[model samples]
Target: MNKTDRLLAIVLELQRKGVLRAEDMAAKFETSTRTIYRDIQALSEAGVPIVGAPGLGYSLMEGYFLPPVSFTAGEAVALMIGTDFVEHKFDSDYRTKAQSAREKIEAILPESVSQETNRVRTTIRLLVTGETYNSGREKEGLEALRRAILDKRKVRFHYSKNIPGADGNRHSVRDVAPYGLVFAQGSWILVAYCDLRQELRHFRLSRMSDLTLLEDSFTFPTDFNLQDHKPADDRRVLVRVQVHPDIADKVKGAGSFFMTQMEDHEEGLMATFHVRQPEELLHWVLGWGADVVVLEPESLRNRVREEAAKMLKGY
Candidate 1:
């Protein structure tokens, strides 16, 4: 970067990180420490308030704020698209904020830049299924969970599992300490500390019913960081299926989370899936009817056969 841009970037960095050492700034800007010193001197000469201590690094003076910076046409487009995504995916509160942010961004851009950004953004679109209503149940659940997480409070809900238990029960009540919310695979997932299980658990908001925020509060763990949290992977069973050539593209495009690999074959496409259990794929496999044939895991094939028989009997 040129000296002018690098000097402006240094000011923004100080505003963002509060304090940064000369060595760190030099490394970040890919320049020498001597160059950083000269840049700092140049900024001071330009009347930018930079306070440097012997032991502590350089910091912007308290109450000093950088004026607004101009955005490139590409940057403006990216930010506008982000706002569009937020408005479509988030709840009512965030949707309004996103719209306001978009307006502010557009207002600051030059007319030429704004036109270019608009032209580029028209080619891109965000299509979110099952989020038609702003006040849908899932969005409502997200709003409630967001509040509970911020307040460090407990939440109660009835969750419906995908599979029924031995007693044919598929629903259960849970009391949990809300930690964070994650959006994955077109669904909102809640990460919380389950009071009953005495451990962290993940719950899909779509499967959650009768969610209630409790008055009880809990201390947020200091060590728990949502950015670094990785959910355990438990998919162990491997099931392979052969797809007829006609529907091979459709099968490949299904984007099943359990699907691992797809190999071209003379007969058709061999699609491999890794799941927690064979039953987890039973319905999905049967959905393809005659087009898909289970190649392994006799249990899934048998289950599919039984289900097909049941369908035939109904017919």
Candidate 2:
């Protein structure tokens, strides 16, 4: 192997096994002992902290690991380009952490790797979100919710829910213990237990105000599974929907959106889906416009007709 290849291999060997005898490396690389000694000298001159003793062979200094040296120019461009893209779309508060991680990655990389990284950083570009990003408020709530979820601990936060037909008197405010945070439709939602309802519930983090983390903690029962915590089967009503033939490929796939077996129909393709609430799916069906037909479960058909009539009245 050439000098650069030999040096990189030696560093890798030291890292893998924690130590290597010069004689052993020389034999592995098919180089003479004298040449290996010269390579070691060159490596030390280049700031590599290689530790060794006459009888013990050679080992890298503790904590001073070397990175691979054979990275190509094209590869570096790819990394910097990708990192730049990620740097923007990532949450604002997490951006700094991402940058720090980038620095560590650049540090461990060999010159070719580092150079390629820089080339991409300098040559490639990314579109920033334009809008000011402040993850401060969102970050704290998420952090608290994350910790609670991972450790199976609980956190308390104040929240509000709007009451129907009550105008200003409709606002209800209270505290809850957060159990899990879920990402849906580009928003963050906290699933928690309502001390009032005595059941698990989901709340939009963005909608919550005066959020504060509580010191008190609660344990999730070994029986409590997050996957099974959605509104219970009682609230999940089965409604059949007919998907138009043209839209079948688009709508009839696996998801909470539609139930299985999207069969072809005279009017359209028909299937069933479980919905806990009406408003969300109502909009979804409308988004498909006239292409989808809401079938069976008279409640759903009535709901669609009622909503449609309301839309016409509004217009």
Candidate 3:
């Protein structure tokens, strides 16, 4: 960051955090302590009310705040897009807040900048895919989970996994201490400490039902940071399928998340997928019928045969 931008950011950080040590500021801005000292001196000379002590850190004077800042047209457009995303992706409560935020941003922008931002935004669109994106039930579940995460409370719900358990049952009841909410691949996933399993697990909001907030509360782990948490990757199964050339473009357009690679083949198009289990691609393969053929993993082929036989019986 330039000196001017860094100076403004340091002041904003002080205002937000109340106080910060020189070492802490140096680390945050990724600069040397000497640079931070110089910046603080510069701010002091410019009439910024920064008070520092020998041991304690530097702090902004009580009741001091920076005046309204200006935004370039590009910056304005970026903010507008962010608000648009929040309005569409979040629940009713946050949707209202995003609308208010967008209004405030537009009110502050110059008329020319506002017009330019609106024109640019019109050329870009955020499309919603899948049934779970804006479903009322999904929205309600997300909102409930959000409240649970913020309140440090436990929640109870019945979850339906794609694969059945050893008992041939796909549904199970769970009581978990909510840790965080993640939005990935057009789905809302709740990362929590599962009471039954005694470990952290990810539950898709769309597969959850009868979600209820419990009065029982739990303490969030101080060491656990949602931003740094990396879930184990379990998609080990490799699936290869051959698609007829006639529908190759359509299959590519589908944009299946599991698909890792696709290439033209002598027979047709060779498409490869990575999944947690072979069953995850069952219905997807069946959707193409004769146009698609599973090349390996004999288990998936046998299962497909059985399912096709069952369909013949129904006819």
Candidate 4:
């Protein structure tokens, strides 16, 4: 980067991290400590509120803040693409907010950069499937749920419960202390302490109705860590599958979420995934049809064989 860009980046880094060591900055910028020092000196000369101590490294002076910085063409394009993804994948309220944010960003950018960003926005497309869009009531409920979670308040909602051999869905009003929200598999799930069940439960946001934010406040448990929490069936089982070469790239791209490891093989790509349930893994493998073959876990293989036979019978 040029000296100007480096100085701006240094300000941004300090603003983000509060303090940073000269050695670390040097390594991050791929430059010598002397160069970093020179850049720091240049920024100081420009009246930037930078302070340094012998052991504490460098920091901006207290209460120092920089004005909004301009984005390069590349940065603008990236932001535009992100907004596009949000618009396509998120709920209507979120999509509307994203569109407003994009407009505000565009208004701040230089004409040339703005035009390029608009071009990129028009060209890029992010498509997703298996998503159920929220109705107006559900959108309002989601907003209320987020507020309840943030405020450490309790919430009440009528949840639809699916029971085996039931005539229809059973509806029950549940009082829950909101904890966290999770977006997974194209659905929003609320993780909360259900007063009705007397335990933590995952409630599908879509299956909830008559949502109401309670005035009763709750104390958030200091010991409760969302990252440490796991379901009863959290034991991971390794599932191996072979994939066709044509779809290998797609399979590998999804490895972060599933298919934890993959390698090339003579037949195709050998992929390994860690899943809590064999049926969950089976469903994913079956989605690829003949392009994928389960290689391990005799139970999963047998299940796939039975499903395939049923499919063939339908044909």
- Highest-TM-score candidate: 1
- The C-alpha TM-scores of every prediction are 0.93, 0.53, 0.87, 0.67
Cα lDDT tens digits, model 1, 1-315, are 999999999999999999999999999999999999999999999999999999889999999999999999899999998999889888899999999999999999999999999999899888878854423778888888999998889999999886711334488999999999988888889999999899989998888889998999998789999999999999998999999999999988886888999999999999999988888887788788899999899988888888899899999
- Candidate 4 all-Cα RMSD: 5.3
Per residue, candidate 3 scores C-alpha lDDT tens digits across 174-254 of 999999988888778889999999999998888889999999999998889999999998889999999999999899999
lDDT of 4 by residue, 177-254 (tens): 999877676667888999888988889888898888889999878887777876565638888888999998887776
lDDT values, one for every candidate: 0.90, 0.68, 0.90, 0.83
In model 2, where is the ten-residue run with the lowest total lDDT?
163-172
User: Model 3 — which ten-residue stretch has the worst lDDT?
Assistant: 160-169
Which of the two candidates, 1 or 2, achieves a greater TM-score against the reference?
1
Which stretches of model 3 miss by more than 4 angstroms? 17-35, 53-58, 131-134, 164-169, 263-267, 312-315
Candidate 2 lDDT by residue in tens digits, 69-133 = 54466765665556665465444445677777667667777876676567566766675433323
lDDT of 3 at 222: 87
Q: Clashing pairs in model 4? A: none
Alpha-carbon RMSD, candidate 3: 2.9
Two-way lDDT contest, 1 vs 2, winner: 1
Which residue ranges in model 4 land beyond 4 Å of their true spot?
Answer: 21-34, 53-57, 88-96, 128-138, 160-174, 193-202, 220-315
